[model samples]
Target chain A: MNRFIILLLIICSVLPVFAADFWLTQILSRSIILGVMALSLTFLTAYLGVVSFAQVTLAGIAGYTIAYFSANTAGIGAELPWVFAVLLALFFSTIAGALVGLIARQSVGIYSIMITLAISMAFFYFTRQNYSVFNGWTGFSGISAPSVMGLDLGAPVVFYYVCLFTGALATLFVVKFSSSPLGLSIQGVRDAARRVRAIGIPTSPVIVSAYAFSGLIAGMAGILNVWHQERVSSFSVGLGPTIDVLIISVIGGMRHPLGAFIGAITYVMIDTFAIDLISRDRFNTVIGLVLLLIVIAAPEGILGILKSVKERIKKIVLN
Target chain B: MKFFFIVFFNGLTLAALYFIAACGFTLIFGLMRTVNMAHGALLLLGAYVGYEVVEITGLWTVGIIAGGLTSAIVGAAIQAYILGRYQGDELRQTLITIAISIIMADLMLWAWGGLTYQISLPEMLLGGVRLPILNVGYSSVRLTLMAMAAVTGILLWLLIAKTKLGIIIRAGVDDREMLQALGFETKKIFVIVFAIGGMLTGMAGVITGSALSIAPGTDMQFLLSSLVVVIVGGMGSIGGAALGALLIGMAEQYGLAYAPTYGVVFTFVIMIAVLAIRPQGLLGRSEK
Candidate 1:
């Protein structure tokens, strides 16, 4: 199963080079960028047992920041470096994320969920109404994509490779972080908060820091998302977007970071094709039903089932 | 002064409805330790049933009763078959309930076509009288809701505080294994508790629908409000849920009347303040 996934990944990574329209390539690129955002969620939820509903809002904050800076009117000057704008936006999002995390850090269990949900809702409404800067519900348009090192990165295929490379780098970072002592401690905190606290691990700071880190990644993805679509709106930070991320993480099983990408691909596939097959209004119904079946039949997700099958085959051979 | 009084009265009315809905959610969470995300969906299910009943039979009381009964039956069956199977594992139970919620919500959307449906209340109950403080048109049905919910709250308090069944439930919440060892059927207790919780939610639904009408996103809105109530009330405390609902209701009402645009912000501010002061909730049991 691992080999098969890897092979598929390789094929997908290399396919655009052979043949593809810019539009189709853009879709794939957007999915990867979304995958990055989902990957950030994977870190907090899968690794840390904190099912934060605020990551998308963090992304929204960052995306709007980027758009505000890059907007032709009353935004950052065209002469001002785009890199500076992206960094500033990311910093803003990280701070916003930290503030939200601080507010939410005190509560555990369902309270945490409510706190995050409230914050997300507030951000969504604030953005939807704040027309002076955010351009209100209509959102900002015509923000030019960044041009780094004289490369026209706006090209779909070029952007796809960029997303692919960045995704690989982020995945590596996540894997390393997961294997580190800090990551193990996060997991420890999740499993037994009292035990971890009793041992003097100072779990709260660790979790809060993870939230910051996760926010940074999500913010970066948000910047990329704005670049990909050249648009940012209130809907990007709403409940639907949050649920989409959750579906990706949960469907892929929150156990591993790779699950994010796997889940993202499956989600994009389902979302892109499933609606066409059925009444468009029933899309949520289909997705919801799929999620129900997954929860019922494969609580550990696809990875767990494959692992079990692999174990069974090995046991049989050994016997 | 009159305007303030009107806002206060409106807030109280909203709070009464919120308390009715949150009562069941808090009870189930308190007993089962399960975060039934589907509770809001179940409420919607009840509203839809009531909508159908009122549309067909044109009897408002019958509709409300039928709605509550339907929710109770469905809640019992799900608890027995799905939630009961995963006793003690809160996370798995939550996931199962969330799945159920998702399916139920989708099915509701499919059935109801995202249209707002109003219950056919009797004219006497639908109209209102002007109070001296304000010329308010309050629904007589909402009055019934307020009265019914208050009575239900008292009955529940008596059940849990003054009866053997309540004793067993309280004891079981503290130590399920001990309750089991004491020859009590904890599973049966869970089913009964879950069904009652569902019935309460159903009652809240029909009442709210009768007051405000039923719509597609109504479940989500009510769920958000119930969550706020549960948080402020602290998990598993019936009185706490009521207090939270009252506070939120009043806060939301004042917010809508005064700020208008910042109603969501008002609820959130209270939530943040509560979370900062008491993370365990105003009424939640101590967590070490």
Candidate 2:
């Protein structure tokens, strides 16, 4: 597993040398950013046995915070320095994630779905209706990527590398975190809250901290996303993105965190190239049908199907 | 005082719409334990179908019936064919329904275009009337909406509380295994309930078309509200749906009136409060 991830990372890092500009910007960078967003959900699902519909919302919050603090064409946010903007964005989004955890701490499974969906939708509506900070329907635009700390992110390849670096770093963090004492307890809570509580560990704080950690993961992607799109709007954080993140997580398979990138690449490929297979307008239809088939055929996602198929092949060969 | 009453009427009008839409949602969740996220799509389908029927036939009643019937058939088909395959896995079911919703929404958008359509009301249900005491003139169509909500609630109560099907449904809800062991076809009962729930939503969609306008995103708006309504009112309780709708609708309208920017926050706040104070919801039974 480690070898596979390292190999994947190597392939990603060097691909910019030969990859087309379109693929680098449209597919690679976008997937890395979206993969990180989906990573947040998958982490909770893989470890915590809960799915949050607010992963996109958390990312959006981070994106919005950066948008609010940075200089923009919309001229609504305070013109904070790039460094402050980035840090504050992550900080705010992480805190927002913890708050979501706090509010929905008790609910599990389907109940968490309801709470998270409501929270995400409520944020969507708030951004659309509130003109003061979010700038209402037409959110901030005319934002450009700022180079910082000797890195030139203005170049597509450079930005893609940054996204890759961030994504890989996050993946490493998740892998390490899952084996830590706190992470094990989180898994314990996911498996049996009653048993975990019987061991004298408070469950809510563990859950809340997990959410906060996922928030940081999502916030990193959110910051990159705003820089990639050069704008942050209500639409970015709306139900569309919210569900898209969930779909990516499911498509990648929920078992491993790295599956998010696999799912992200697949989604981005389909979304971009489906125009050739069919009309561009019917993309949603195509994607929905794909998701439905995946859910029905392999509820654990593509990774699960691969694992089972591999096991079957191994069994046949052994026999 | 006059302004308060006006806002109050507005709230009631919105509440009626919400209750009507949420009825089917609560019903499906109650019997099948499936969230049926595609409910809003079903409602939108009914609304569009109703509009087309009314446009061709020039009869509002026919449009309403046709809309309801179409949604009923579709809803039953979905449950019986797709959702029934995975009976007890709520998460998988929810994901499937969500996929269905996305497909339906996209397909509907393809067929209907992005234009908004409002179902024209019958002459009798048109126009407005001045309230006797408050002197606030409200749309007659809105009044009819409230009336239809009441009718839906009462008739649903009768079906659940009085009828044999209702008894079986309640039994199924209480213990699906026991109900199945008792030789009852719980699957068939689930399809029936889905159909009934779909019918309620379809009619509500038609009524909503007359009361307001619907476009591409209307499905999502109703879906989110239904989620909140059922969550607040209790998962599968008709009375809870009504109460939840009323509170949400009232709070929403009042917030919009008093603080346009923070209107949505009020509903969020209320939901959080309910979850904090009563995780099972206001009238919801505590989970075992």
The best candidate by DockQ is: 2
Q: After superposition, which runs of candidate 1 have C-alpha atoms over 4 Å from their true positions?
A: A1-10, A22-27, A72-81, A141-144, A179-181, A195-201, A316-319, B133-142
lDDT of 2: 0.92
TM-score of each: 0.92, 0.98
Residue B3 local lDDT, model 1: 84
Error of 2 at A87 (Å): 1.8
Docking class of 1: medium
Per-model lDDT: 0.80, 0.92
DockQ of each: 0.49, 0.88
Put down candidate 2 lDDT per residue, A225-279, tens digits, no spaces.
Answer: 9999999999999999999999999999989987898899999999999999999
Worst 10 residues of 2 chain A by lDDT: A145-154
Candidate 2 docking band: high
Summarize candidate 1's per-residue lDDT along B1-288 as a digit string, tens digits: 878987888888888899998988988988878787888898999999988998899898888888998889999988998888878666667667776777788789888887888887777776776665467776566567668768878988998999998999999889889999999999899999989999889978888888888888788778778888888778889889888988999998999898876676788888888888888778888666
The superposed Cα distance between candidate 2 and the true structure at residue A53, in angstroms, equals 0.7
